[model samples]
Target: MKKSILVVEDQSSQRKIMVEALQKAGYVIFQAGDVQQAIDLINQQKPDVLVADMHLPNGDGGDVIREARQLPGAPVAVVAVSIDLAILNQNLTATYQADAYLSKPFHPRELLKIVEELVGVSH
Candidate 1:
């Protein structure tokens, strides 16, 4: 089966870019502009992984992960993306339990590599 991913980002351009890149990498993709939309998709589809921006319109991505963790199967892995690495890295490993972190404006190669690694897809 094709691995699936949900991408949550408040920025439309960034979201579109990510969606295109991941889709090119062969992931079945879903998108949301905020945490609430992400949660709704998670509850409905349960994608294999989630790539979410740290700051969102309605809520933080970490909160979305917390809620997702409570659901059956949850996400196979979660990646938190943020521009403010200094702020987001603080206690993130303990607090959010995220599988990985990607800084904003990152290269598509780096992001896709992480996604492939998490979903066990051979490059």
Candidate 2:
């Protein structure tokens, strides 16, 4: 089965970019623009991977990451993305229990690589 990914980003363009990139890489993609929507999707879909922007409209990506991690069944690998240098510099993987972290304006290939590593898939 194809691995599924949930992308939580507030900016429409940024979310689109991530969705398209992950879709092209052959993963099933789900997207949400805020924390509530992301959390809703997480409970419903239980995606294999989660790529979340640190800043969001309602709450933040950390909320979404926590929700995913708390879900039962297979564990979800979380990737936290942000433009904030301070947040990026800090160990978000430890702080948020994320599987990885990516800085904003990152190449799609970088996102793909992280997702692949988290999901144990190659493309």
Those runs of model 1 whose alpha carbons end farther than 4 Å from true positions after fitting are none
Compared with the true structure, all predictions reach lDDT values of 0.84, 0.90
lDDT of 2 at 88: 81
Q: In candidate 2, which residue pairs clash?
A: none
Candidate 2: global Cα-lDDT? 0.90
Taking the tens digit of each residue's C-alpha lDDT, what string does model 1 give over 44-81?
88888888888888788888888667777534588889
Clashes of each: 0, 0
How far off is residue 34 in model 1, in Å?
0.8
- Name the Cα RMSD for model 1: 1.5
C-alpha TM-score for every candidate: 0.92, 0.96
